[model samples]
Structure formats: C-alpha cells, structure tokens
Target chain A: MRFPLFLSALFLLLLPLTAGAQTKSINQFYRKYKHSEEVFNITVPGWLIKLGAGIAKSQAETPEERAAFQMVKKFKKLKFMVMEDHNLVTPRDYNRLISGVQSESFEELLSVRSDGARINFYIRDKQETIKNMLILVHEADSFIMVSAKTKLKLEEIADLVNQALDGDLDNEEIVPVIKPQA
Target chain B: MKTFKILLALLFVAVGFTAQAQDDAISKYFNKYLDDDRFTVVYISPKMFQLFDKMDLNLDDEEAEAIMSVVKDMRSLRILVSEETPKQFFDEAKKAFNTNSYEVLMTVRDKGGDNVEFFIKDDGGTVINELLLLVGGEDEFVLMSFVGNIDLNNISKLTEAFEGDGDDANDD
Candidate 1:
C-alpha cells in the first residue's frame, strides 16, 4: 500500500514539470546571453512597471500621452536584450531563436525587411488577453529582442488609441460595437 | 504490457502522418526555405485569427470597419522575401505549387521589369480559401500567402480602404 502511495505522489510531483516542458520561452534565450559582455539585458518587474506608469500618468498632458500610459500600465513585465556585437550571435542561433519562440506559440504579427535590416513582431494571446509580445530586430551591426508580458487585449489598446485620436478620453460611448458588415 | 506499448507507438506514428498529409502546398514550400539564411520568412498561424475574432475592434470609420471585417476571417499569413537572386526564387516558387489548382486573379508587369501575380484558391464560389501574391523584381522577391475564408467583396472593400488612405499620403 505504501509503495503505491509513493508512486502516486511521485507522479503528481512530476506532472507539472511535464506540462511546462513543452513551452520554449524567450526567457531561455535571454538567460543564455544575459551574462555575455557584448549583450545588454534588462528585466522590469510588474511593480516597477506600474510605478513608472503612475509617474507617466501624472505627467501626461495630452490625451495621447494618457492613452500611452494606460497601455503601458497593463504590461505585467518587460524584458529587453540587445547585442551590439554582430559576432556574438551567429545566423544559425538567430534562426533557432525565432523558431524556438514560434514553438512557444508566438504568432507573427508583422515582419518587414528592407535595406538589409529586418524587424519581426510576434504575439502570444489566450482567449481575449495577450499573454506575451515579442519584437526582434536584426541589422547589419546589431540585434535586439524585446519581450513583454501582459493581460491586456489588443482591442483595449486600440480603443485607447481611438479615444486619444478623437480627443475624447472621457467618452465611454466610443466603445467597440460589432455590427454585421453589409 | 509490451504489446500495448507497441500499439501506442503505432498510433503516434499514424497521427504524425495524418498531420503531415493535411499541410498545404504553400506551407510545404515555406518550410523548405524557412531555415535558409538568404530568405526572411514570417508565418502567422490560425490561432492568431481566433484571437483577432475575440477582439472588439474599434470600427469608428468605414475604412476601419472594412479592414476589420476582412481581418477577422484570416486564418494564416506567410511571407517569404529575399533580395539575393530574387528572380530565381520567384521562378522556383512558381514551379513549386501547381498553378492549375488556383485561379489567376491578376497579373501585372511594371516598367522596371518587375512582375506581380495574384492567384486564388476558391471553393467554386465567392469564398476564397487562399490568396497567393508573388512579386519578382530586379532587386527583390516576395511570396505571400493569405489563407482564410476570404470574401471577394470584402477584398474590394479593403482595396478601397487602402486607396482612400493612400490619397492623403505622399507616394513619392
């Protein structure tokens, strides 16, 4: 009886690990290069972000600034890494990093390549909330990666922008209304 | 127990094959060049479209509304671009997919020796399953696949919206 109980306990303990094993996050890439001399990385926590947002909100003068603050406040965490030395990251590693993030369910939102420079945007969302947003920019001399975690929906941000653009931040009547296209 | 394990392995193999069989021709071609250093590739999956549907887009203007209507139906978008030997890649892409399976929507040849072609896979109706655009120029090659339940009418609306927006901006 004790042996069976032990087996069940072990299975329960290992179950969560197995569930998480499938996710290949950008954090793994960050952690790998964070210690490199040529790489610059910073991770801002949720509280710090909220504090910064508060300051920005207080200083905001225009509706656009307030709208930007509202959007920034929704982010739970932000991470950024940039490598100024092109030799630090190989082409193979960069490709692998892109593939790895895709494996983590990050869907490409936009990718633009021009004049030997490329910029890629990816987002991972669950239901109505965006869970993560990633941006990777590759140029001749440098590479940059930024990852943001949030529980905000794209429409919420869009609504904020729309309100700002309309110069009616207090107007709640401008909320999104879905009507069948005719 | 050994027999059960063997049966489970066979089941996994069968599942893998089924998934592979369902992949579209464009996707297969995209995957082939995905790891190539010369090309820049982008792929948006179906799950993103599901999320887009859930969003309450602020359709305050006619143009925004038209764009949102078309965006909601998009299942996936793939783009492959290269500046090196662009014409070669364009020719290779043309041969990779069966042209007979798609309807040629439009073809344009510019003064700069650039070629642009639009192909659509339809269900014998107004609904398009996939819209493929190929651009081959002296300095750039672009292959884009927009997969979705695209309505022909909405595409015209989208084009109109873009044209309306373009009028306010400088082209040169």
Candidate 2:
C-alpha cells in the first residue's frame, strides 16, 4: 500500500515537468522538430505569410524599399537553421525534404549548428506554406517532421515562431513574407 | 646648292607638321574615352599584352619600329590594342598637361566584348593612346574598376572577390 502511494506521488510530480519541456499545442503552426544529428527543420503557416506581407508594406517608404519588400515575397520562409556538433548538414539531406514538401520553388537560407552538435535550417517556400519541418535522423529508413505551428493563426503564432526559432521577426531581410505572384 | 638648302628647310617643316597631326589625333582619343560610363578601364602589365586585345601605347622608338614592321608584314593589321581610356587619367590632367580643353581624334569601340575607351594626350602627340582614367598619375596605371560583367560586385564579401580560397573567379 505504501509503495503504490509513493509511485502515485512521483507520477503526479513529474507530469508538469514533462509538459513544460514540450512545446505548446498551438506550436503546430510553427513547428520545430529535431533530428538526432542536430539538424532540424522549422516552419510557419500560410496565414502568417499575409500578415508579414502587410507589415512589410506598411514599413516601406520609397520605391527602393518597396522593391526590396517585393523581392522576398514567395513561399514560406525558413525560420532558423542550427546544426548539432557544429557540423554542416550536407546537401544530400535536403533531398528528403524537397521530395516530401512537393513545392516547386525552393531556396536554401542559412545553416547553423548548436553547441550540442545539432544542425538547423531556414528554408523558404516557393509555392506553399511549410506543412512540416522535416528532421533527418541517422536511421536509413526513418525520417520525421514536427509540426511547427500547432494550431495558431498569424497574430498568435508569429510571436510563437519568433520565440521558438530565436528568429528575427523584425529583420525584413531574413524573414520576408512569401506571397503569390500577381 | 642654294636650292638644296631651301628644299631641306621645307622638308623640316613637313616633318613638324606630321608630328603635329599625330598630337592632334592623340587629343581626340582622350576626349572620346573620358566622361563615358559604359566603358571601364583597367591597368595591365606589358606581360599581359598577349592576354587581352586592342591595347594602345605611345611606344618608344624600338617598339614602334618593331610594331611597324610586324603590321606591314601582317598587311591586315595596324596596331594591336586591348582597350583604352582617357589620357587625362587624373582630374588634374586637364590643367597639368596644359590642355585647357580636349579634342577627339580616334575612337575604338568595344567590338562587343569588353567595354573599354581609348584616348591619347594631345600634349604627348597622338602617336599612341594612353588609358587615362586608370592612371594614378602621369605615368602610373592601376586597375580600379569593378564592372558588372566581371562577376565582382559591392556585396558583403569584398576581399574574397579579389582573392579567397572559395573564390570562384575564373583564372586563365
């Protein structure tokens, strides 16, 4: 009877810790999934794309400014790229992602790595808001993408993405709104 | 014998006229190349003469003699030039060279590859065209242009564009 009570107390104490470690549910909209080698993919949703576009337009003051703003309007942008062990993830790894995303136009952004040997990526969408952040693992047959933005809309999710990827939301150069061509 | 002396004096006058004509052509060359943006100038070594086309120079006696012979033998060529710029390569050349103004004599078009302008100094006489804008001073030349077609730009990686390990500049 005493042992069972102890076990129940321990389970109750650990539950909140586990919940705190995992991302919030609305984080599905700006997914941050990790691969074992420290390389991971992160994404933002379609709705936030429009909102970012509006903000970019409001900030511009001149023809050059407007031209710069127009240049980056395309698919979903890669948020941040980090690598584990500070090693670069090879181009071969991107094949798995490009095949799955099914977006026709894509461009690679920065590739960074963390102290723990994890790699990161910031890829932009050419045709679609990223549905997934594909994480490539060492296993030959296994791969996965964590849902970045859980279920949040633009206003709610933009903050979350900025916080999650350590992204520079204010940096129009880094995270431009990807819009369809008129 | 008196007639011979008169003939000799006339011949001397004719020689002076010929020299003056060459100088006029040189002045013309300078005007055509200067103040034009479509063309850029580069300073090259004599060793690079074989590497580029349509080079211009106010050659010394030996070089001019050799070139004259070569051109005469070739029959279809006058002189080989890569490209050229104004002779007043510096801002002060207009005043320093005693040429208050410039008059054009010859113009060499880009032939559709490298946009270069050629000019010669009127003061020096137009026996040759000097790349004016590329020269730091009267006799010195340097490469200061970063043209669009050269694959170099004002991007963040300035130093790498000149020489870097990963630099992708084509070296012939």
Candidate 3:
C-alpha cells in the first residue's frame, strides 16, 4: 500500500514538468503529415549547419561572403517540407493546411498574394527576439513550408535580402516552383 | 569563498542581462514576423562578404581595389521587404528610432512608389557606427540596417563605383 502511494506521488511530481515542455506546434504538424504520400520533409540539426557554415566561411574573402557566413552561425536547425502534386493535394486542402499552420503559436510577419499564389511568413518570438521563423507558400499544385531556428536578428536578414534584390544574383533565375500567377 | 561565489553569480546575471539588452527595435520587429511568408527576408553575414572578397573578379586594378575597400570593411547587412501597405510599419519604425535618436542623413522621394530615407547612429563625431535605410510606398516596403565601420567619404566613392549601373537600373 505504501509503495503504491509513492508511485502515485512520483507520477504527479513529473506531470507538470512534462507539460511545461510542450512540443512546438509546427513540430507536431510535421509529425502528423510526415508519412503522407505527397509530403517531403527535411530536418537538419545544428551540427551539420555549423559544419556547412564553416566550410563556406573558409572560402569567404569578400565583405558580402563574410557577412553571409557570419549570419549562418546563428541557425540551430533547418526544417523544410513540400507537399506537391495537384492530384494529391488540392488548393482548398492547401488552404486548410495553411489555416492549421496559422493556428499555431507563430505570428504572421508578412503575407504576399501574387499570381494566384500566397506566401506567408510567421515567427515565434521570446523576450522581443525571434527564436524561430516559418515560411509557408501555397501554389496551385503544391505547398512549401520552411522553418528555421536561429539567434540572428531581423535586420541582418533584411540587409541580405536587400543586397540580393539589388541584382547581385540576377544572372541566375531563382524562380518559384509554382506556376506563374494567372 | 562564499562571497566570491555570490560575486560570480552576480557577474553571470549581469552578462545575461547585457545579452538580452542588445536586441534593438528593428531586431524585435524582425523576430516578430520572422517566419511570415509574405515577406522576402535576406541576410548577409560578415563571413559571406569575406568569401566574396576572395573571388577573382578580373576587373582592372582601380575598380577592383575600390570594390575591395568597400566590401572588406562592411560588418553586416540585412534587408526586409514586403508587398503590402506599410504605413503602420513606417510609424512603428519612426517610433523605434525614438525621435532624434539618430541623425537624419538624407531623404529623397524617388519617382514612382519609391521614397528613400537614411538615418545614422553617430557618437558625437564624424564616425558613423550604423546606417538605417528605409524605403516605403504602395508597391513595397523596405528596411535595411547596415552596421560596420563606415566612412562617409568612402560611401561617396562607393556610389561612384555603382554609377555605371545607375543607367541600367534606370532602364529597368
């Protein structure tokens, strides 16, 4: 009788601790859809990210290259998923997925609708700084979601994008996989 | 020994506070919408810039050297853009600047939907530590923060380096 009471007490003691460590909503979503036929999921932890940044940093010689390499150091993990094939996933279904995604703790940072495609950016912040960010894009035939956990400040990322749009990467066409907006 | 331990604990607490204090207003905004899809986010780290510096662009000596000088000193650059009404964002940005917290470097109303504004964080001297670039209009909203060792004279030269490209930009 005493042993049974002790066991119950131990279980009660650990309950709140486990509850406090709730799994992120995005991670839960990934687990739910990971085995689905149309979903392609990729998860990379910090070690590989640091290794890649190190290799690129070794080759860095210009100001831009060095800046980019430095920024990569903040990333802790990269998670990506693409659910494609229109026959497999309809636009309405994609919208539902997006709604489900928004229902999580992530707050919308930006939303773009162009050419019948919608892209949304969301982030989870703590103490006025972002710890993780998610990007969701829905095209006619596919949906793409990318999540990054990093310590980088928002302005740093913005500067890099500005530089890119300034046409340094213009020689190569980096078009979206989605069809052009109608 | 107990006193020393307490002092060490205090030091750690202070360090933690300092780290948290470093998050600026723009960084807070960046964190707020970091994952939002409507925004195109770009980040260029110092290491990436260094990598580019190593490349052999094969330009003539003067041009190559000028480009190198500009690229070598930049610490970090980041830009965020969104295709939406940014009046609210603009107001927030202005508030974050804390009214006269930074020196107004320049402002220009460019043709079309482009209006460019520049602000600088200077420590009571010619040396500028940070440059804030804000562009706003109907088509897009942009915020660019560049932090590094900046020389105003060098910035003028940097503009000259891109003079040839200006025509190309205008054509677009």
- Choose 1 or 3, whichever is better by DockQ: 1
Q: Which is superior by TM-score, 1 or 2?
A: 1
Task: Please tell me what DockQ candidate 2 reaches.
Answer: 0.01
**lDDT, ranked from best to worst:** 1, 3, 2
- The top-ranked prediction according to lDDT is 1
Candidate 2, residue A23: how far the Cα is off, in Å: 26
- Model 1, which residues run further than 4 Å from truth? A1-27, A91-120, A138-140, A164-182, B1-23, B45-47, B110-112, B137-139, B159-172
- CAPRI-style quality class for the chain A–B interface of candidate 2: incorrect
TM-score per model over all chains: 0.73, 0.20, 0.44
What lDDT does candidate 3 reach at residue A125?
50
Q: Write candidate 2's Cα lDDT for B1-172 as tens digits.
A: 9999999999999999977765454344434543343333222222122211122322333333343333222211112111233333433333333343233333343444222333333345322223232233233322222111111122223344335423432442
lDDT tens readout by residue for model 1, A37-125: 88888999989999999899999998678878878899998988888866366667777888988877677777665556668788876
Query: How do the residues B122-156 of candidate 3 rate in per-residue lDDT, one tens digit apiece?
Result: 77765577788887776777888787767776777
Higher-scoring candidate on DockQ, 2 or 3:
3
